[model samples]
Each structure stands twice: as structure tokens, then as C-alpha cells.
Target: MPHVIVKMYPGSSEEQKEKIAQEITNVIIKHTGKPEEAISIAIAEVTEDLWIQEVYDKEISPNKESLYKKPGY
Candidate 1:
């Protein structure tokens, strides 16, 4: 099972989110040869004020394994 998580600021419309998820599912299907029905996508809208503490510190600073590519690393 491939679960995709999109973390960003909250502002996009529901239609936009739907489009994003559909696009992501297409990519996953092409790359991983997984069926669309087998893939899952979740969007995590994080407030800019807490991005550093919630994502950077916990996910990035903790050895940088969770992050594939970032600006300064």
C-alpha cells in the first residue's frame, strides 16, 4: 500500500486538493505500477507558524532521513 502525504499551508480549494490527489495518484501509478485503487493520499495543512516545530524539527532535524531534499538540509 502506497500512502501519499502532502504537507503544506492551508488555502487551496477542495477542488484543487482533489486535483492534486488525482495527479499524485497518476504519478504513483506510473512509477510504482500500483493501481489507483490501491493508493491512498492525505493532505496535512500545517500552519506556517508551527511548520518548523512540527515538520522541520520532528521530521527533518531528527537525522534528516524523512526528508529527501530540502533547501539547506
Candidate 2:
């Protein structure tokens, strides 16, 4: 069994996340000789404030809102 964890800013579409999970599972199954059902994929959506990075003492926020027209429901 293979486990994969993906963490990103909280603005990805459901379709996008599903596609990514499927693709990742497929790749893991192909390379690791594991069954598709044996591969596990998890996605973690973090808030924009939590996804910040500091550059030269300046806080840089990731533009997660631009990923979709409507983010959270």
C-alpha cells in the first residue's frame, strides 16, 4: 500500500482535486507495482494566512483566491 499526501492553499476546485488524486494514485500503482485500490491519496487545504512565506522579512501570501471563482462553500 502507498500513501500520498498533498497540501495546498484552500482554493482548488473539486474537479481539479479529484483529477490530481487519480493521477497520483495511478502513478504510484504503476511504479510501485501496487493495486490501484491499495494506493491512498489525501488532500489538505490550508488557509491563505497559514500558507504564508517570509522573504526578506516581508510576508508573502499565496494567491489562493485566484484558483477559482468561488472558493469555499
Candidate 3:
């Protein structure tokens, strides 16, 4: 069971989010051999003002070893 959470600046439309989720699901299925029904994706809209404290600092910075692609910022 794998759950993916994507946190980004808010602006994407529902269709865009759906497409992104589908693509992510496809990749996860391809790599992990997990069925679509076993994967869950969540998109969280984080504002720029709160991104550092809420995301980068708390999540990315602390989990650098786990990150596959680190942010340049």
C-alpha cells in the first residue's frame, strides 16, 4: 500500500490535478507493480507564504535522505 502526497502552490485546476494524479498513478504502478486500486494520491494546495515552514523546512529539509529530487530553492 502506497500513498503519495503532492504539496504545491495553489493554482492548478481540477482537470490539471486529475491529470497529474493519473500520471503519478501510472508511474507508481509501473515501478512498484502496484495496482491502481492499491495506490492513493493526495494533492495539497500550499500557499507560498506557508510553504517554507509547512513544507520545505518541516518535510523536505528534514528528509533529504529520502528525497529522490531535492528542490533547488
Local distance difference test, candidate 3: 0.96
Candidate 1 local lDDT, residue 29: 94
Pairs that collide in candidate 1 are: none
Supply candidate 3's per-residue lDDT for 60: 94
Alpha-carbon error at 18 in model 3, in Å? 0.2
Candidate 1, 1-73: lDDT as tens digits: 8998889889999999999999999999999998889999999999999998998787768866655776483
Ten residues in sequence with the least summed lDDT for candidate 3: 1-10
**Candidate 2 lDDT over residue span 1-73, tens digit each:** 7787677777889999999999988888787889987888999886667554432113223454454433342
- For model 1 the local lDDT of residue 60 reads 69
lDDT tens readout by residue for model 3, 1-73: 7999999899999999999999999999999999999999999999999999999989999999999999998
Clashes of 2: 0
| Prediction 3 TM-score vs. true | 0.96
Cα lDDT, model 3, residue 44: 100
lDDT score, candidate 2, position 51: 54
Model 3 segments beyond 4 Å from truth?
A: none
Instruction: Using lDDT, give the best candidate's number.
Output: 3
